[model samples]
Target chain A: MAQQTNNFSNWISQQIEADTTFTLSDAVRSPSRSRLAEGIFPTRKDEEWRYTPLGQILESSPDMDSRSAVTPEFINKLKDAMPQAHTLVFINGQYSENFSDNQTHLENAGLRISRFSQLNSTQLQMVEETILNAALTDDNIFQHITLGLAQNGLFIELAQNVDTQTTLHIIHISSAQGDTSFTNPVQVVRCGENSHLKMVEQFTSLGQAAVITVPASYIQMDKGAGLVHYKIGIENNETNHVSNTSVRVAESGTYQSHQYLLGSKLTRSNLEVSFTGPDGHAVLRGIYLGDENQHLDMRTYMDHAHPHCSSDQHFRGILNGHARGVFNGMVLVRKDAQKTDAQQTNKNLLLSRDARVDTKPQLEIFADDVKCAHGATIGELDPDALFYLQSRGIGKKDAALMLTRAFAAEISQEIELISLQDYLQDKIAASLNEIVNASI
Target chain B: MLSIKNLQVSVEDKPILKGLNLEVKAGEIHAIMGPNGSGKSTLAHVLSGREGYRVDAGTAYYKGLNLLEMAPEIRAREGMFLAFQYPIEIPGVNNTSFLKKALNEIRKHNGEEELDAIDFLSLIKKQMNLVEMKENLLRRPVNQGFSGGEKKRNEILQMAVLNPTLAILDETDSGLDIDALRIVAGGVNKLRSADNAFVVITHYQRLLDYIVPDFVHVLSDGQIIKSGTKELALELEERGYDWLVDKAETQA
Candidate 1:
């Protein structure tokens, strides 16, 4: 097992050594480089990765030289999901200026959107400070890998009191044909005081591409600032995706995140949020729907280090065929964090006998005047509900579809974007149609 | 319009309905009154094609077609409706959309063009008025957070919308107050026509006071022991079911 772990680390180290296009400064890369030098990867014995197996990702090689072409029509098809938003496209981790909208307009509006390669000295210093100050309690080796070797990413900064009505949509398309390709994209968002920003990050592939995507994001919210962030993953069946995101909220700041993991052979998402000052709030909602031989894992950590802060999290999973899902969440209230309110809920629905889910919701409260509650449930569709629909003139398959859609609608309806909500609902329905047809 | 002969049924290896027989034509209402565990609900469930019921030896025919061989949805599409005693509370399913889908499915099955959104809303509004149902109920999930009376009214609302040929009321008056019962019975009376039939199943004869039944039958131990006009309900109500049960046992 130790030998296998070394080989996986060595594979990543060799890719970093072979890449000549690496652009980050040595100061930003040295810490991760020293950590990666240990040449260790998580094994099944590790508590953090007990349920997620890294065999497929370790066995495949990421060919850096191979690149797949993407057509304009394909990008347009994705752009239709949010037509009113300003769009940016990335193919194989490299930003495409030809496809992205002009950034001069946004710059004029006091929103600075700069690529990592184009970051000025002050912006680069801000990125380094945000990374250094992140209070992540569950940092892992994959995060170090993305940090050490990433060459493509974005740094978005909004000036004080600048709230834009338009949303920022970033699209990442992984299209690798000859061999398994790897791409790591890091994003950092710095919201100034009294400002608000809405951004969406979408990851999708071109056809059935073999790839491994490792992405990381760091967000910093100043006092009285608000950030609405959305991350959507709809990659192909042969893709393996792992992501890490850390957030820090200051006083009176608000952070809301919605993650929809819809496709991929194997996916593991680790998210951590910490309250840096009192009166901060965070809301997290997500859904992971898997089918066939897919495996999906979601892990979250809420750190309430200040007083008078609150966090609410609700996540749901739907698995069919031989899919496996995992939800491991923890909410921590420090001794000094008085009057903290935290609630966590995770619910899962299994459509087939072979499908499985392992959920663990935990709360650790140290303050005496705190309200913390957590709950987890895993079950199949209600048989009585199915019969009721069938007795009302709906066919068996259609009845199953209706109940399953309703299960997801509870969360999808909470999305503030109507177009995105409808798009996700339609996608969920299409996937459920396949599962119902195959099983029934 | 409906016929049954020796309709014996069992649930989980226990016989619930043994040799039950009934017959009804168009433009008629039959009331099946019995005590608890007398197979009133079993008959209704078996007729509606609910699962977990085994047909030991019997047959049910609707319009000369075998009802036992059809699925629940197929039976529903063929104009058979059953108003549940305890309606299901299905969260997240919108009431209006569910009814619209059911209506469209039945219409499509009968080779009728599906109703558009506007037409469906208009029809549902008219049916809601006929049933005196609150308009707010249409915006909530089906039967979720509904009061007992509201659930019964929703069933009647659905019945009015679907417009079935043969409808079965399975203890629809079990938990209703006097006013709710009157309103429900009034909805049924308004929907009754020469082309439709109703089979009202209740433990008491109070429901029969409003929706007068043309035929009343005593169901004791799963079989029809007595058959008469609506006045039989009045006799059974005054004397109770024990006398009728004793008379049937002596006759056996």
Candidate 2:
């Protein structure tokens, strides 16, 4: 069994050796190289990755194949679906200048914007330092793999007291053509004191071939800064997505993350937030839909390290057609973190008898004065409710779709951007209809 | 017009309705009164096509169509409605949205254009006055956290909005107070016409006072043992059910 496990990692290493394009940047070349050589892929024995099978992802890689290109028209089609924002496009892990817009205008307004390759040597050093600091606390192997494999990524910074009224949209499109491929895209964001920024990260694939995406985001917020981050991952059926997201908040800072997972054969997302200063607040909300033998997992960790900090986590999921889901949330209050208030709730609705969910919400408090609560529930759609809607003359499928949409509406309604909220609501409705119709 | 002959129904392999027969015509209000385990609600469930009810032998005809052969929504679209004794509480679906979907689906089945938001609101606002239901209830989730009277009133509100040809009230007045019963009955009365009909099921004679049924039927062991004009309800109330059960057994 152990030898069988080693086979997949050895195959990955061999594939990495055969690919010349996969190289580390000059700033942290040696460290990233050693990290890559350390074999970041975890086996089933690892507690955090026990439920997710890594061998399936390893066996699907086409490391020796060439990267497929995307056209400008394809990017424009994607941009038209999103709300008005500064759009940044990346194809197969590399920034595409031909498809992106508004970089110069944003830079002129004191908003630092650049691709990883566009950054100067000093900027590269800063990125390396940030990666090192984040590595100290992040035990996720996917994050290190992203650090080792990512060639270019979007980097943004806001000056003190500067607010970008418009959102920053990042679209990552992966095209593997007929070959299996992998893409690692990283993003680093810094918000200065009293500044505010809203960003949307969208991941999509264009080809029929299998693709593996290891995406990571590292965000730092200074005193009184605020950041609203939303991520929508709608990959193809043959794709695997592993996302690692971390946010650090300073004194009186605020961070909110809205994650919507719609499609992927297998997806795993890890979101972590830590309060390093007093009076920091974090709101984490997510809703996911799983269909057709898919496996979706979400893990969240909230750390309250200072006094007078608060965090709330709300996650809901709908699974149908033999799909499976997992939600594990933990909120920890340190010894010195008094007056810490943390709340977490996870609810799941399964549409079929075969559909299943495993959810656990844990709260750990070491502080003397703190309030923490967590709850989780898994249930199927109420037959009485379905019959009620059907008796009102709504079709069986339509009734089910309406209930699923209502279940997802709680999370989508929290979006501050009205247009984005409407856009996501439509997507959710369409996807639910498709899932219900297909089952019939 | 509705007709049933030798209808026998079972739930979980246990028979509930055994060889029951009844007929209801347009412009008629039929009140079905019986004791607690008399399968009053079972008739309502069987008519609405609720799951888990197996018809061992029966033929129910609604406008020359086989009612039991259709799905629940089809039965609803075919102008059949059931006001549940216990209305379901859906926590996230808005009341207005739920009603509009139901209304439009029924209209579409009848080859009529669906009502837009503005038109639907206008129509619902008028019906809301009949039930004396507050407008704020439309903004909340369907029956979620609603009081018992509010839930029953909401059911009547739905019946008014749908305007089905055949409406079955299954113990709708059980949890209602006297004023609420008057309002709910008034709403049902307002919707009455020569082209539509109602089947009012109740355990007490008080609801019949407001609705004023044209015919009253006593159900026992899933069969209509005794049926008469409106005075039968008054007699059943005056003498209680023991006298009727003994009479039914003696006649059998």
Candidate 3:
């Protein structure tokens, strides 16, 4: 495992030297940059990353940014199906105007979606002089250097009382003629007071053995305003992508985020949503499926900073083969945050004896008047239930699928968006398809 | 028909059944009334192949096949049913789906075609009337948040749908009220047939009042100490299990 992770990092760094879009300044070439890179790939020393050994994943893994050389047909299909979101296309971490437009809905007033490196000094000052600076710091040593060396991503904002629906799709296609490389793209979203917005960001890699590191933050959502952010990271075994999400929910406002992690060799996502308002609420929902030796780690913190605010966190995963999964949901209710209602639940199903899951549903409450509950369970298929199904004529594989589906059905029921819910159901069907076909 | 020969069982390293034995032919309703700690429910669990209880000695044959040789589900598929004394509650798992899978598993095991959604729904509706169970209970998860009486009725409802040939009702009448007892007993009576058998394990004679037994026996100390007609239950009901315990003690 150590050798595999070493080989993967070496291959990724070499690809960086060869790729034009992955260019980095001298600041990005330090030991600190490599340390931040370590945060994405877990080490044996990390507690939350216990079950999934990042070393093992890197050993046999492909590059994280090895997306395919695009075909015209693929481009056409993407343009047709892509929602009219404030779309931003990033090809190997470089802007692609042929697939983007900044003049989106409600963005004419104090809103800009462009390359981060292209921002003026005033914009750079705004990025420096912001409340997000406290929470979005590069705590991981390597991430600090990467942030210093990185350039060019996305910058979005929602002016006070301005309602907008901008869909941003970051299509990351790997170069056809190169080794698997790495690209750290940082995107920021801000919503002013009394404003409303919905954004969907998607990341996909096309090719074999590509690795991409996404270190991004959204200083979005203001008092009396609402934001719904959806992130769908779907990459094949050819890529290992890691993303960090920091969300800020203001008083009387709402921040909702959903993550669908279905692809990647080794995927680690750190999501932190802080409810710093009276009566503010944050909802974090995610679904991650791991097959083979695929490892997906999720560490979330729903910090209630203000009184009467609430947060709901739910993450469920399915593991097959020797696949491993980790979910650490921390619901922290600070002192004086009375009347707060916080709930966190993480459930997993291990399809094989070798499949493993480590889930810690943690709740830290200092307020006595608050209500918080957390639960986590890891178990194999119920034998009596399985026997009950098989005796009725269902095949063993079908029976296993039924049990796993039943476990995840409760979470799927929570998705209010019909199309998204339908999409998830279809994905689950595809997972079971192999089971049915395997019998033949 | 079910037959047990020199059946011996133990639970948690404690011997419960020591060379105990009984037989029930098709169409026969055999009632086994035992004193406390007499291994009656243990026999039911062991017969159904429930985990934990180990069979130290004995061979149980259900229609010439080794009953203990099969898994719990295969035994269920093979027409052997054990209505648990305390039915397990599984929330988030629907009653309709659980029963459908169970029925279909038995069908599939018998090499029958699997029922589609429409057919399965209609079959569930038909069985709902047989047990007088509300269609709503069938919609909920198995035994989840159900009242005591409702749980018993649901168990009988499953039995009606699965159509088991040999049912060992292990004190299904304990938690039920009088009305619930009547409804459940009525369902069991309706399912009784010339080709099916029953072993009703109970403490009180009240359950026998609803579904009268063909034969009654007093089980004491892991073995049947006395056997007689249905009249024995009435006598024992008039005189508690202590009288039988004393008789067994004197005989020993």
Candidate 4:
């Protein structure tokens, strides 16, 4: 076990040195290495990871080699998929400056988009203080790995009161040639006071090779700021993804996270949102679809530390074949956090007999005046509803697809961006089609 | 044209329909009314190929096809429709999309060209008016959060859109008010034609008053004990099911 732990750190240290395309100051590097050494990889014995066994994944460690270039063909495919958004392409976790678009317009709008390696000393200090300091926790070894080993990533900062009209689309692609490689990319976002910004992160793989992606994002929303964020992971079927998202919301600030997981052999996403001031609000929504031998696990923690703050968390999962899913959501209201309103709901649909799901919605409210409600449900498609549709000339397969689509639509309906919503709808349909075809 | 002979059905080993027999020709409206536990629902579900019911004996023929041999959707494609007693609320399936798909599936099965979006919208709009369903209901999920009256109306609207040759309405008037009942029956009355038939199953004579049945059959303990014309419904309403139960028992 100790030897395995050493290998993880030694591998990360090697990557950090070999990939110098993006530069990081020693101030940012030394602490991340110490933090990575502070913890070991978690196992099923860990309460939060009980449903997802990671023995096989940790055994197959990935190599972090030289950065790859984003091909024009890949850029064209992404443009065809999402034509309206301002796109930023990343190949093997290294930012591709040549392929990115809409930089001038974004710059004029008071949005500073730079590579993480390009940060000056003062900027690096700010990142070290804001993100690296807060993101490294005891249970999140992957987050430590991401911050410590990542080569190059995007750093976005919005000026105070500036509203970004166009959404910034960040596309992270793992090249097929990078077989058994690690792509640990970290993104830092700071929305200034009363500012507004929307961004989407897409994790995809270009080839059939298996890869391990460890991406971490830290977002800080200033007073009255509003930030809409989406993280979509549709990597290769053999890929294993672990993403960590930590958010801090100031007074009256709004933070919304929309995450959809469709591919990958194993996926674990951790989202933690903390309200620093009163009357802040946060909304976290996720929909995960797993098929074949996929294992999907998502954990969410919402902390209402200030009075009159409100938070809502909802997650739905659809598992088929031999797939398994786990959703553990916790909402906490401190003793002085009175008048806090928090609602959490987790619903899962198991399409095959072998498919399984474990959902736990936990709420710990120390404030007596707070109104918090949480619910969790796991079941197959409603037989009665299926019969109702079948009675109207819809085939059994078509009826099942409709019900599956309906189940997913609950999460999709809350998406604020039409283009992202449309893209997700197609993904949901394709997943449902695969499920139906497999059953037949 | 439909015919059933000695149909025996059971649910989970509990017999619900025993030696049930009935017949209905095209252009005629047949109303099956009876007391509780008379297997009216089971008959409707069995005809529509619901999953649970098992036909232990006998056969049902619809237009020379073995009705029991086909699946639910196949039965629907063969022009058979059943308005559920408890309409399910499918949260995200829009009423318009559900109806359009159903209409197209039926049309495709009949070797007729499927209607385009414009024609489908027009057809559904006309049928929606027939059932007095508001246009907004079309945008909402199928029967989701719909009032009792609205769900029944939606079911009738589907019947109108699909134009089934034989429609079996199972307790469609159970939860409806008098006004909703009138609108639902009015829609059914308009769909009556020489090329199609209706089998309206109910527990009361009230629904029969609007959609005047050409023949009325009283089902008791899974079998039809009596048959008469429209006047029989009124007689049963006045005398109650007990009088007929005693008469049928003494005769048996």
TM-score of 4: 0.96
Q: In model 4, what are the clashing residue pairs, if there are any?
A: none
Per lDDT, what order, best first?
1, 4, 2, 3
lDDT of 3 at B102: 78
User: What tens-digit string does per-residue lDDT give for candidate 1 at B1-252?
Assistant: 899999999999999898999998999999999999999999999999999999999889999989999999999999999999989988889999999999999999999999999999999999998778899999999999999999999999999999999999999999999999999999999999999999999999999999999999999898999999999999999999999999999998
Off by over 4 Å in 4: A1-10, A13-28, A64-70, A132-138
Model 2 per-residue lDDT tens digits across residues A88-175: 8888877777878857777767688877767887776666665555552437667766776565676788889988786888999888
Of models 2 and 3, which has the larger TM-score? Answer: 2
Q: Of the candidates shown, which would achieve the greatest lDDT relative to the real structure?
A: 1
Candidate 3 error regions (>4 Å): A1-67, A70-134, A141-151, A155-178, A192-207, A317-321, A348-362, A366-368, A378-399, A426-440, B249-252
In candidate 2, which residue ranges exceed 4 Å CA deviation?
Answer: A1-32, A64-69, A120-126, A135-138, B249-252
Per-residue lDDT of A30 in model 2 = 51
Q: Is candidate 1 or candidate 2 better by DockQ?
A: 1
Candidate 1 C-alpha lDDT tens digits along A313-358: 9999999999999999999999999999999999999999999999
What is the DockQ ranking, best to worst?
Answer: 4, 1, 2, 3
Q: Which scores better on lDDT, 2 or 3?
A: 2
Question: Which of the CAPRI classes, incorrect, acceptable, medium or high, describes model 4?
Answer: high
Model with the higher lDDT, candidate 1 or 4:
1
Candidate 1 accuracy as lDDT = 0.91
Candidate lDDT (C-alpha), each: 0.91, 0.86, 0.72, 0.87
Clashing pairs in 1: none
